[model samples]
Target: MTALKRRGTFAYFLVLVTMLLVWPMGVILMWAYTPWSKSVKVAITICLTILTVLTVHSVCYFRIMPS
Candidate 1:
């Protein structure tokens, strides 16, 4: 196969891996926060946001990287 095709395949795999992570991460974030702990909620929110951004960025990065 061509280099571009290989990169595209890698990108697809990355996307799938990220998608698989989203649900468990989300659940963990939810469980980490409760009504009593506003601090934990805010921290979890920030972490989840960063995680999402990084996942998107990584997928795009791999797609553009030379293969």
Candidate 2:
């Protein structure tokens, strides 16, 4: 008898929660612990990087502009 491996919902939930609480650590956890494929991980990393860059750029631009 062969038993299939299943990742629990709690683990996924934890990842999401951790991401909300501490993004950098959560990203590290996602890479280190999760069984997700490399392509998925790379896609997520790219998305996060783009989002971070956009957010910082927007904040900086807004802060510098006159009212």
Candidate 3:
């Protein structure tokens, strides 16, 4: 494959990895939130939200970036 194709492929893989990795963390955060301190739960929720946003952004960025 050409370098551009390789870069695109790598970008896709990174997005996949980010999604896979964040999903479990998000699940765990959801599970851990119940009965916990509001502050802690809110923090985890915020972190999970940010990860989800980043995952989506990376996927879109990879798809549109010249490669």
Q: Positional deviation of 15 in candidate 1, in angstroms?
A: 24
TM-score of 3: 0.51
Each candidate: what lDDT?
0.63, 0.81, 0.65
What CA RMSD would you report for each candidate?
16.8, 3.4, 16.0
TM-score of each: 0.48, 0.80, 0.51
Better by lDDT, candidate 2 or 1: 2
Which tens-of-lDDT digit does each residue in 1-67 have in candidate 1? 9998887677655544543577455445344432337776567567767887898999999999999
lDDT of 2 by residue, 1-67 (tens): 2233335566677887887778777788888878899999888878887888999999999999999
lDDT of 3 by residue, 1-67 (tens): 8998887677656544543676664445445433457786677567777977998999999999998
What's model 1's lDDT at 52? Answer: 75
Instruction: Highest TM-score: give the candidate number.
Output: 2
* Highest lDDT model number: 2
Per-candidate clash tally: 0, 0, 0
- In model 2, what are the clashing residue pairs, if there are any? none
The runs of at least 3 residues in candidate 1 whose Cα sits more than 4 Å from the true structure, single-residue gaps closed, are: 1-33
